[model samples]
Target: MPPNPDLRQTIDVAPGLDLAATLGPLRLGVSDPCWRVEASGPWWWATRTPAGPLTVHLVPGAGVVGVEAWGEGVEWLPRHLGRLLGLDADGPPAARTELVRALAQRVPGFRVAGHGRVADAAIDGICRRGVSAFEAARSWLLMVEAMGDDAPGPGGLRLPPAPRRVASCDPYELHVMGLEQGRADEVRRVASHASRLEAGTHDGGAEAIAHLAGIAGIGTDAVEHARAVALGDPDAVPVLDAHRTAAVVRALWTGAGADDTVDVRSLLEPHRPERGLLVRLIALVEAADAADDDGGLTP
Candidate 1:
């Protein structure tokens, strides 16, 4: 055979862009089946797309992010690659404040990555709302394993359930998996409207986020979470769970955690359009500090 060539697209990135910091957020956990970053370097993802399931490989260099893929989703994958890696929006709006300057120095080359697959993003984000990280991860895995199709081009990877698969599920069945009754109902509703949600990604900006208001069960947290990944808002903040909120709070006030999105938004106001990106950078730093066994003193 010669060569098959659906793959197309390259993203010019800053030198030393930390792929791990960028893409780590996509996985539900280190064991998440949707994605992997090899110890040697390359990143791989088994993702759902508007066209279908795709297995994507990303190779990073000094100023470019190379792309390769195989499966039904190939045609649609290239179009959304930029948003997939959270490169859709421009970076910080210029570091004019002291805090901005400090964060810049503290977390150089930090980039937040999100898989801009609308319906899929909505599923993951909605699953995570109002739950413990552990519970959320388990819930997500349960749903995927139970309803998702076998991915076409990768080993040990499962596609996120298609809208039809999810929409057809009985809400009670989902509840048994981990979601509460309300959230389970929300999942079904979202699945029923997956196509519309997917279309919103194309709408972009406030209009897209605004469309979520019509959804009954999707609350502010879920909408914001969906916005982060679906819209590829680099500044998309997803205080993943209370731990993240605690970390952000600890970094700011050196005390207990605060679950107030309003206050957190206020605290991060100076970062402006980059607030979402800023949180990711801080979370990365906090995780690193935790790895050092210093109890993660800073975010």
Candidate 2:
């Protein structure tokens, strides 16, 4: 028999609180083992919490979102569910700026995703450092299947390797999953301090990012990426690599070389208080536009 949910909670929703838009950032790709979505239906998420593994199903409809979760970690999922559902996210205030005003038109009532498990997100973020999303997603899946446990319920899901498990990994093992030596060591370093990292997660983004940045191999960009993916924090500094920086510069500005040397943080300053959410929104729109241009999804 399929496992029954150990707990159930119905979260009230605001209009236009889209499941796809709110939770999209947590998913590395369509094949991400940590998540599952049915056609026009609820999505499943298998997560590794501090307590243990959890499987969650979210059903979205008018003025409400229903959540059901099971497994050893169900108890810990509730307090953090609000953070994950975009409910706790700061909404656009009066739309004073052009960016805010335009976002109001394009994706209304959108919420950024919050990853409740800081260490798990950090691990996945490490996998993503200096690589393509496809590579990151694939490496994450393989690493989980090879070292993690099966999640309860359906969708054949698996959680990311636990913090203790990651902490114990030999660099060569993670290397087999496509993590270079530096990232592999970084993974272990972060996982070794998993307790402290998780303890400080609630201390806010700056503190958490500062802690992560001090680690030998981890960069501020990766930490910010983890913060965005892990916390859905609106305050997170955006991760701007050369390619993404160029894309933003071209799409948003006219003259490039002279005026826009690097100074990404300065350019993005105006969007503060909502910078992380804004970056996610732009990516979502760009991805949709690309799909539409390519004849859209095929059956």
Candidate 3:
């Protein structure tokens, strides 16, 4: 029987969110086809199927309250999605020191927390490689809706898909999702072994990276990205990509320097052992809607 789709109920969109800016960029401004989110907190959008475009916006501190679905069950949002999307209510220490200070100065909504989402991070990395941000987001929507599990949250909304289910997906299925074979293969490979690597933040930082890197299509940058989802390891520097790199430079040096040629290690040297924390702190501070530009100073 086809799974029922109207099982979600009760979502409290957290107060104090600047929906206009945050939701737009965070959700790639509707660039992703499978999912479309509104600029309202605690709002819900139903999918054509349990696996189709499902969007949920809850209060900053709000959580799941109820759920009801057709095809499969829905409960608990995926940890990985939270990590990549910066949805976790809590924050973690930065990987670099200067990042800690810089973040302390910029990026208001950023937080420091352990890794949250495993599958989303892996799939996002693969699908995004060599593609435009819009293309990657679209591919993600296609891939997840096709293979992901439905978990109920605060309003009975199903969370992103599960790793086990994703691992078993066929390449052709991803093609149906509008994804090419190579990206699909990468997603499968990462999802296949997600369990071994999804070992919570405080526990599996280094090990998870090594394991993720072992998969085909995954590289140093990919592994670091996974670590961010898995452990929220603040130090998981994404030095490979151009956009993130540019963001890093701009956030770090306040310059619109080219990301392609920048060196991650050299840039992060200022923070040393605590670079990750600093970077995230900067992001968090910058994300804040109301800021004095003094970077929250007591002076």
Best-performing candidate as measured by TM-score: 2
lDDT of 1 by residue, 108-179 (tens): 666555576656677777777777788888888888888887766544477887679789988888989888
TM-score each candidate.
Answer: 0.85, 0.87, 0.59
| lDDT per residue (tens digit) for residues 1-299 in model 3 | 43444443543333333333233332321444323443443334222221333434333333332323333212323323344234453432333344364544444444444323454566656666666666666677655556554433323333455666777766787767656777677777887876665444465446666677777676565666556534556556532335545556766664475555666567777765555554444444444532455575411
Cα RMSD of all models vs. native, in order, equals: 3.8, 2.9, 7.8
List ranges where model 1 is wrong by over 4 Å.
Answer: 1-11, 90-93, 199-202, 205-208, 254-263, 294-299
Give the worst 10-residue stretch by lDDT in candidate 1. Answer: 253-262
User: Model 3 scores what on Cα lDDT?
Assistant: 0.49
In candidate 2, which residue pairs get closer than 3 Å at backbone N, Cα or C atoms, i.e. clash? Answer: 115-230
Best by lDDT: 2
RMSD (CA, angstroms), candidate 3: 7.8
Report, for every candidate in turn, its global Cα lDDT versus the true structure.
0.70, 0.73, 0.49
| Candidate 2 to truth, TM | 0.87
Cα-based lDDT at residue 268, candidate 1: 72
Ranking by TM-score: 2, 1, 3
Q: Which ten residues in a row have the lowest lDDT in candidate 3?
A: 42-51
